[model samples]
Target: MNYMDEHILSLKNKLNYDVASNNVNTSLSQTVISEQDHSVSEKNLALRLGDELIPLELRVILDGEIEVSVPKSFSLMPLEQAKFKYPSEHRPEVIYTSEDGTVNITFNRTESTLANEELPEFVEQMADVLRSVQPIRNWLGTQVIVNHSGLSIGLIRFIAAGVDKNLYNEILLFTHAGQVMMGTFNCMESDMEAWLPVAENTVHSLHAVSLPLQSSLEKGADSL
Candidate 1:
């Protein structure tokens, strides 16, 4: 089966939503509760991804364990530690990749405390770690503070190109619910024009949501 088909099947099993498959187009549709009301609305369609609105049909399974939009052309997979190595305690939670593997979005999370450090300090430390892996050729840093859908987030954006002239990376760091989250977008330098907007939108979509009680407990246990 194709990656798209496999992703849809995984969503079906995970979310139990109404999904229809067709050779030409596959779609997922569901009625969700509006934030303003306790009543369910049929037209309350589309999932909110940061400031962007993604059609329901294009959304993959998003629950509390991890939340992010899955664009039609991308497939979501669990991070395999054996495949990628990083020096920090922060680890990749999930990854979204295009069919050709030329583009990738990685979601990572790490724990932090007020007593240990602040956001700016954490960003600098993380930046050093990233630079250590691959020397950065050019870098730009910015801060994003947004409050939307009752969620307020402060993020640090790092735009860097590595020594390899062919690749570019955009990494965002933020803290939510006592955990630091990083969203990294990497793509060919040639494809930046077409993929950068998508990557930014995905990064802005990060928010704090409750994971399944059992899943939360299991993660806590593993950390012990």
Candidate 2:
């Protein structure tokens, strides 16, 4: 199955959501990426969240077809480790995770064709689907932001009931090259206050770049 399909199955089996996939955990690591770490050839991408002051890094990932600012401490999740952390045979296409596998930022490119103006209503429709599928979840509503490139990004937040603990789930939807990209930021429900802004800023920092078709989003390192 494709990444999105498997992700949706994992969502249903683990996080009590409807037709979407992603998860999060506890404790943010303290590994800093400083100015000295960046080369002159790259754009300096960074952000600080709350009193914790976690640093962000510029990463061209998914076979180097997309540019995103993620926490400096995040790493691509290993396949073996992903199985237990996500508790599913299916998971997101690219998963950048914490040391303990509790928190995550995931990306999955879907075949859906989306237009710029349709993002807000599309996000609402997703919310309605989740509501009908799991009304017991703590509903935290949704928001829409247009990136610097005028791409509309849809953000949905909620507290999801998990088998062991609750998770603060944020679902992001946007399009690039007229195709949908579903990304997610998740952390422990208890850590929502500290991680929420990190998630938001990370989404704001998202932008795409051109690349050869051979190094496209269609393929990438499954684990690291």
For model 1, where is the 10-residue window of minimal lDDT? 15-24
lDDT for every model? 0.44, 0.65
Model 1 clash number: 0
lDDT of 1 by residue, 1-224 (tens): 13323322332221111000001111222221122321111223343334555432223222444455445546764345314432233334555665545456666554333211355555454545544544345555545445333333434333334334445566655555655555666665555555554554555444455567998899999999
- In terms of TM-score, how similar is model 2 to the real structure? 0.71
Give the true-structure RMSD of model 2. Answer: 8.0
Candidate 1 lands at a TM-score of: 0.53
For model 2 the local lDDT of residue 165 reads 64
The superposed Cα distance between candidate 1 and the true structure at residue 209, in angstroms, equals 2.7
What is the alpha-carbon lDDT of model 1 when measured against the actual structure?
Answer: 0.44
Per-residue alpha-carbon lDDT of candidate 2 for residues 1-224, written as tens digits (9 for 90 to 100) = 24444434433432342123343344453322234333323345344444455557777766666788777767998888766555654466778986677678888776566666776777776666666675336889899987654557998888777655677778888888887788888777777775665676567667776666766645664432
